[model samples]
Target: MGDLLGVAVLGAGHMGADHIRRLGHVVSGARVAAVADPDVERAKEAVAGLSGVSVHTDPSAALDAPGVAAVLVASPGPAHEEALLACFARGLPVLCEKPMVPDSAGALRVVEAEARLGRRLAQIGFMRRYDAGYRRLKALLDGGSLGRPLILHCTHRNVSSPGHFTSAMLINSSVSHEIDAARWLLGQELTAVRVLRPRSSSGAPEGLVDPQFVLFETERGALVDVEVFVNCGFGYQVRCEAVGEAGSARIGDEHTMVVTTGGRAAQEVAQDYLVRFADAYDREVQAWVDATRRGRVTGPGVWDGYAASVVAEAGVRSLETGHRVAVDLAPRPDAG
Candidate 1:
C-alpha cells in the first residue's frame, strides 16, 4: 500500500459527490484516484480540481484505474452488489453505502461471498454508528448503565421527499438507518416488524405516504419503534430515546444556537443530513481509511448490512400487508 490510500468512488450523485469532496479534502491519508458515474460529465465534475484523478462512465474501469488501491461504493443501492463483488474479486477493501444490497437475497450473496474469501473487506455505510451521540448511547448500553434497554423511540423526518420517492422507500431507504442503529445499539437482531401508515400530509405529493410508523421486536425482547416523516415541510430531524430499566436517555435534540427575538426563542434546525451528520461522515471515512491502510476491516460488516436488508424487507412487507412480518436471517458464516 502507498503512503496515501487511492480510492475509486462509484456514482457521482448527491452522496457520491459529497464523498468525493470528503476524500479529497476532509479526510487524511486518502485521495480520490478515480471516479465513475453513468453520466460521464458528472463524474468529471466530481473530480474536477483533483490532480491525477481519472473519471469513467464504467464503474469497473474506474476500479481498474491506476493508483486505485481501494473502493468506495456510493452508487444507488441496486448497483452495490456488483461493485462489491468486483472489489472482492480484486482483493481490494471497500466502503459501501447503506442497504449494501436492497434485497435480502442479494445481500446474502455478498455476505456469503466475503465469508467464502475467509476475511473481511467490505464495511457497510452505517454512519450513525460513528456519530458522537449514537456512540455515547451505544457505550452506555454496553456498559450496563442503561440496565437492559426496554424500548427505543426513534423519529426521522425530512423537509421533503425526492420526486422518485415511494412509500416502500420510507421503510427501506429512510428508516433503514434506524433499523441498523437499533440493532447496533442493542446488540440484538430484530425478530419481527410491523408498520402503520397514517394519513398523508397535505404538503406531501399526491399518492405518496409521507409519514409512517414502524415497530420492531428484537430477539432479546426489546421493542423499537420509528416515526418516519419525509415530507414534514420543516427540517431534517433524527432523534432517539432509549428507555431502560434504570433510566432513559435521549439524543438528537439539536441544541444549536438559540435566538431570543420578538419575545420568542428558537433553535436552529438542519435542513439536510450533510449538515447534520457532517462530523459523523468524516469520522466514518477516516476510520475506514485508517483500518484499510492497516490491512484490516472495521465498522459495520457485510453481515450487519445483510441483516439490515432482511429486517427492512420485513418492514416493507409489513407496510404493504398491514400486518406483522417475521424476520428470518441466514446463519452467520465463520469466515467473514
Candidate 2:
C-alpha cells in the first residue's frame, strides 16, 4: 500500500469546496493534491489555506494531473458521467457525489465500466450509510431484530437551494437520498415508484416549486415514503424508520431532547446536509481513501449509484404520470 493516497477533487463549487476542505484538513490517509474549477477565483478559494495543493481552472487538468491516485468528484450532476469515465479509464478510484448521474443510462455506463474492470473502483457519496444512527439502524435490521422490513418512512427538508431549483428538483436533489437509503437500509431494490403532490405551502413562492411527496416499493415488498419540502423554513433534516413483523428501528431527530412549552415548541435541526452528515462524510472519505490505497472500495459501490439514479428517474416519471411506476433492475453477476 502507498504511504499516502494522492486525492484530487473536481469542481470547486459549494459541495466541491467543502470536500476539498475536509479532504485537506479532516481526512487522514489522504491529502488533497489538486482542485479543479472553471472559475479561477473559486478554485483559488477552495484551496486558499490548504498547503501544497495545486489549483486548476480546468477539470481536465486536475483529472490528468500526475500523482493523483484517487478523486472526489463534486462536479455538477450533468458533468459526472464524463468526469467519472475519465477516472475509470485511468484506473483511479472515485468517490462521487450522488444521484450518480442525471439519468439511468449515464449512470449505467459508469456501472458497466466498473463491472468490466471487475473491481470496485467507484464509490457513491451516500453519507447516510455511514451515519452513526443509520449504522445502528442497519445493524438492527441485519441482525433480524427487525424481521422482514415491511415499510420505511423517510423525510428530507433543505433550508433552500439557489432559486433556480424547480419542482423537478425535488426528485433529483432531495428525495434521491431517501431512495438510496431505503434500498441500503432494507437490503432491497425498489421495484415500483409513486409520487404525490399534496397542497403547496404558502412559504413557497408562486411558481417556485417545493413540498413534494414520493412513495416507492422495493422488490421485497417493502414500502417507502419520502416527503421533500425545500422552502419549508426548516433546517436540513432527514428521518428514517423501518417497521417489521418482529420489531422496528428508526433514526430519531438529533435533538430528541428538545424542550417544548405551552406556547412555543422548537427543535434543533442541522443548517444543511454538510452539518447533518458531517461525521459520515468525514468517515466516508477517510475510509474510501484508505481503501483506494489497497485498491478496494467497501461501501456504496457503483451498483448503489446506478440504483439511486434508476429510482430517481422512476420517481420523476411517477410524478409526471401520477401513477405507481414499476421498476426493473438488471441482474448483477456478482450479486449473490
Candidate 3:
C-alpha cells in the first residue's frame, strides 16, 4: 500500500458524509485524516465510527491541519466557490463536485485563478470519467473499434432531488454529466446547444420541468442528444450509446449484475446518485490523493470543467430563448 495521504472532506451532509463513510472502511492509498462541517455535532457524527479522524466545526480549520494535503468539497452547490478558494489559498489540491460553480462567471474565475497559480490545483468531480463501463466504452471508441462516432444517445434520470431543485437546475444538476461525457466520447467540444421543453410532468413540483430534450453539436461533426428526466419515478440512471460508422458501443445497465429466483428475476438499480457512482467516486478520490502526493493536479482539468460549464450555461440559455445557442470554447493553454 502507498503511504496514506491525509485528506479532509468539507461538509458533512449527504455527499460529504458519504465520502467519510466510504473512506472509513477501505481506502488504501489515502485515508480520512480530518473532517469539517458547519455543525459540530453533524461533523462529529460524520466521522463517528472512523478511527482517529479529527472533526472540526469549521472546515477551514483543516487548511492548516498536519499532513492534510488534499480536500474534497462536497458542500452544497452554493458554497463551492468559498470552499474552493479556501483550498486554493492553502495550495491544497481539491476535488470539487460539479457545476464547477453556480454559473459561468464563477467557473471563469476559477479558471483564471488556477492559471494564475501556474498549475492546475483543482479537479472538478465528474465521476463518469472514472466509471468502469464508461471508461471501457471510451477505450473502445478511441481505439477506432467503433470508427468515427456519428451520434451519441444519452439519458439522465434522477429518482428525485431536493425540493429546491428547479427546471433549469435539471440541466446544471443532471444534464451536465451529458455535457462532459459527450465531449469525451467524441473527443470534441460542443459547438452549439439547444434545449427543447416538452410537456412538463406533474410528477415533479408544479414549476419543475421534469423532462426536457437537449441537443448539442460537437466540433467534430457529431451530434449529441440527451433526454433529461429528473422525476423519472425510477432509480438514478446515467446511460450513453455512441453510434459510429463501423458499429455502436453502448453502456449496459448497471442493474444487470444479478440473478435472482425468489419469485422473479431482478437486478436492482441504485436508488441514490452516490450509490450509483460509488466506485467512480473512490477512484476519483484516490487520483486526487495520488496527485497531491506528487504536488500536482491530476484528473479532470480546468479546461474540462470550464467547457462543461459553458455548455451547461448555453443549455440554460437555449431553454430560456427557444433558440440554438452557440458555444464559445476557451482556447486551451499549451502544455509545456
Candidate 4:
C-alpha cells in the first residue's frame, strides 16, 4: 500500500464509480484512498469492498484525506472548475474528465489558473487519444506517408439520452469528443462550426433534438464532419475516418462477434460507452497514474479543454441559429 499511488476520486456516479473499480482492480500501482459524491451512499457504495478508504460528501474533505496524493475528477461538468482549481492550489496532480468546464469562460479560467502556477498539474480526460485504433491512426497521420489530411468523417451515437438532457447538450456534450479529437488528429485548432438538425427522432424525448450533423473547420484547411445521434436506439458507436491526399484509414468499428453460419453476416454493437471504450479508459488512467507517481503530468492539458469548450460553444450557437459559427479562442497560455 505504501508503494502505490493514493488517488482521491471525486464524484461517485456512473463514471466515478467505474473509475474507482478501475483504480482498485484494473489499473496497477494505484489505490483509492478517498471517494466523494454529493450522495454519500453512492460514494460509500462505490468503495464498499475497498479497505483503508474514506468516503466523504464533500470533495475537499476527500482531497484532504490521509494518503491522498492525487485526484481523479469524474464529477459533473459544472463542478469541474472548482475541483480542478482545488487540485492546482493543493499542488496535486489530477486527471479531470471532460468538458473540463461546461462553459468557455470557466474553461479558460481553469487554463489561466494553471498557467499562473508555472506548471501543469491537471490532465484533461480526452481518452480517445489513448484508444489503440485512434493511436494507430494518429501515428499514420503523423508519419506523413498519406500526405496532408484533407477531411475527417466521424460518427458518434448512443442508445438514448438521460431525462435531464437538453437540445444544447446535443452539441456541447455529445459532439465535444469530436471537437477535441479533430483538433488533436489534425494538429490544429478548430476554426469554425456548423450544425444541422434533420427533424427530431420520434425515439427522442419531447422537444429534445436527437440527431445532429456538425461540421468543423480546422485551422490547417482540413474539414471534420460528425453525425451525432444520442437516441439512436440501436447501439453506442464512435467511428472516425481520416482522408489524406494519398490514402485513408478508419477505426472504431469494434465488432464483438460475427455470426456467418446463417448465410448472412452480423456483428454485435455496444449499447453503452462504458463497454465500448473500457480499454481506452483503462489505458488513460494507467498512464496518468504512472506519470503522476513520477512527478509529472501528461496527456491533454487545460488549453485543449478550453479549446473544446470554445468550439462546443460555437457549435451550440450554430445549432440554435442554423448558421455557421466561427470559433473565437483566447490567447493560449504557456502549457508548461
Candidate 5:
C-alpha cells in the first residue's frame, strides 16, 4: 500500500457514481484508482474530473489496474457474489454494498469464502450502523437505560418506486434495511416473518403492491413491525421506536428548519436516501478505508449480510403465500 489507498470501484451506476465522487473528493486517505462498468462511457464520466484514474468495461481489468490496493463492489446484487469471491481470491480487502447477494444461498457462499481465507476481507455495506441517530440509540440500548426491549415499530416510506420495482422487492430490497436494522438493534436473530397486504395505493404502478406490512418475531420473543410504503408520493422517511420495559425511545423524526406563515408550519423532508443518509455513508467509507489501511476488516461482515438475506428470503415467502414463514439460517463459520 502506498501513502494513499487506491480503490477500484465496480459499476458506475447511481450508488457507484456517488461512491466514486466520495472517494475522489469527500473521503480522505483514498483515491479512485480505477472504475469499471459495462458502459465504458459511464465509467469514464464518473471519474472525469479525477486524475490518474483508469476506466474499464471489465471489473477484473479494473481490479488489475495499476495502483489498485482495494476493491469496492457497487455492482448489482446478482453480481456481488462473483465480485466478492474474486476479491477473496486476490486477497484484496473489499467493501460491498448491501443485499450482499440478494439470496441466502449465495450470501452463505460469500461467508464461506471469507472463512476459508481464515481472515476477514469483505465488509458488507449496511451504512445505517454508522448513522448518528442509530449509534446514539444503540448506545442507549446497550447501556440498559431503556430496560429490556419489548417491541420495535418501524416505518420506511419512499416518494416513489423505480420502474423495476416488484412486489417481492418490497420485502427483499426495500425492507431488507429494516431487517438488518432490527437485528442489529435487538441483538437477536429473527425467527419468523409474516406479511400482510392491504389495498394497493392509487399512486402505485399497475399490478404492484405499493404498501405492505411486515412482522418479524425474534428469537428472544420480541416483535418488530415495519410499514413499507414505496409509492407514498411524498418524501423519504425512516423511523423507529423501541418499546422497553421501563420506557421507550424513538428516532428519525424530521428535524429540519420549520417555517411559520399564515399560522401554518412546514419542515423540509429528504426526498432520497442519498440525501438522508449522506453522513452515514461518508463515515462508513472512511472507516472502511482506515481499517483496510491497517490490514483489518470492520463494520458489518458477510455473516450479517447472510443473516439479512435468510430473513429476507423468509419475508418474501411470507409475502407470496400470505402465511407466516420461519427463518432457517445456515451454521455460522467460526472465522467470520
Candidate 6:
C-alpha cells in the first residue's frame, strides 16, 4: 500500500467501475484511494473489497480525500468539463475518458487550462494507442514499410445502443475513437468531414441513425472512411485497414476465437467494448499510473482530445447538413 500510487476515481458507472477493478486487482502499483459517484451505493460497491478506500457522493470530496495522488475521470460526458477543471485546479494528474468534453468549445477550454498551468496534468483516455494491435499498426505505418498512406478503411459496429443513445452520438461518441485513431495513425490533422446516412436498420431505435458512412479528408491529402453501425445486433467490432502507396496493413481481427463442431466452423465476436478492448484499457490505465508516479503526464494529451471533439463536431454537422463540413479549430495553445 505504501508503494502503490493512490488514485481517486470519479464516477462509479460502467467505465469508472471497470477502471477501479483494474486499479485494485489487475494493474500493479496502483490503489483505489477514493471513489465518487452520484449514486453513493454504486461508488461503495465498486470499492467494496479495497482496504482503506473512501467513497463519496460528490467528486470534489473524493478529490480532496486523503492519500489521493491522482484522479481518473469516468463521469458522464456532460460532467467532464467541471471534473477536469477541478483536477487542474488541484494539480492532480488525471486520466479522463474520451469526449474530454462533449463540445469542442469546452474541450478547447480544457486544452487552454492545462496550457495555463504550463504543464500537462491530464491524459485523455484514447486507449487505442495502447492496444497491442494498434501499437503494431502505428509501428508499421511509422516504419515507412507501407509507404505514403493514402486511405484508411475503418469500421465500428455494436450489438446495439442503450435506450438513451442519440443520433448525434453515432458521430460524437461512437466514431470519436476512430477520429483519434486516424489522427494518430496518419500523423496528420483531419481537415473536413462528410456523413451519409443509410436506411435505418429495423433493429435500430426509431429516428436513430444506426449505420452512417463518414468520410474525412486529412491535411496531408489522405482520406479516411468509417462505417459506424451501432445496431448491428451481432457483435461489437472495430477494424482498420490502412492503404499506402506501396502496400496496406489491417488490424482489429485479432480478437477472434474459432470453434469447429458439427461440421461447421464459427468465429466468436465480442459483444461489448469492455470485452473487446479489455487489454487496451488495462494498458492505458497502467501507463497513466506509471507516468503519474514518475511525476509526469503521458499518452494522448489535451490537444488530441480537443482535436477529436472538433472533428467529431464537424462530422455531426455533416450528418445534419448532408454536406462536407470543414473542421474549424481554434489555435493550439503554446503548452502543446
lDDT of each: 0.94, 0.83, 0.82, 0.93, 0.94, 0.94
Q: What tens digits encode model 1's per-residue C-alpha lDDT throughout 157-265?
A: 9999999999999999999999999999999999999999999899889998779999999999999999999999989999999999999999999587899999999
RMSD of each: 1.2, 2.5, 2.2, 1.1, 1.1, 0.8
Cα lDDT of model 2 by residue, 263-296, tens digit: 8887777777888888999888888888887777
Q: Which regions of candidate 3 deviate over 4 angstroms?
A: 1-3, 256-263, 333-336
lDDT of model 2 at residue 291?
A: 82
**Candidate 1: misplaced stretches above 4 Å?**
none
TM-score of each: 0.98, 0.93, 0.93, 0.98, 0.98, 0.99
The residue pairs found clashing in candidate 6 are none
Residue 27 accuracy (lDDT) in model 1? 96
Q: Among all windows of ten consecutive residues in candidate 3, which has the lowest summed lDDT?
A: 327-336
lDDT of 3 at 190: 93
What does candidate 3's lDDT look like per residue over 154-256, in tens digits?
Answer: 9888887688888788887788888988888778889999999899877887888779999999888999999988888878888889899999977847564
Candidate 3 local Cα displacement, residue 259, angstroms: 5.4
* Model 6 lDDT tens row, 1-336: 888998999999999999999999999889999999999888888998889999999899999999998999999999999999999999999999998999989999999899999999999999999999999999999999999999999999999999999999999999999999999999999999999989999999999988999999999999999999999999999999999999999998883789999999999999999999999999999888988999989999999999999999999999999999999889988996
Superposed model 5: Cα runs more than 4 Å off: 261-263
Deviating ranges (above 4 Å) for candidate 6: none
- Best of the candidates, lDDT: 1
lDDT, candidate 5, 35-142, per-residue tens: 999998888889988999999988899999999999999999999999999889999999999989998999999999899999999998999999999988888888
TM-score of 4: 0.98
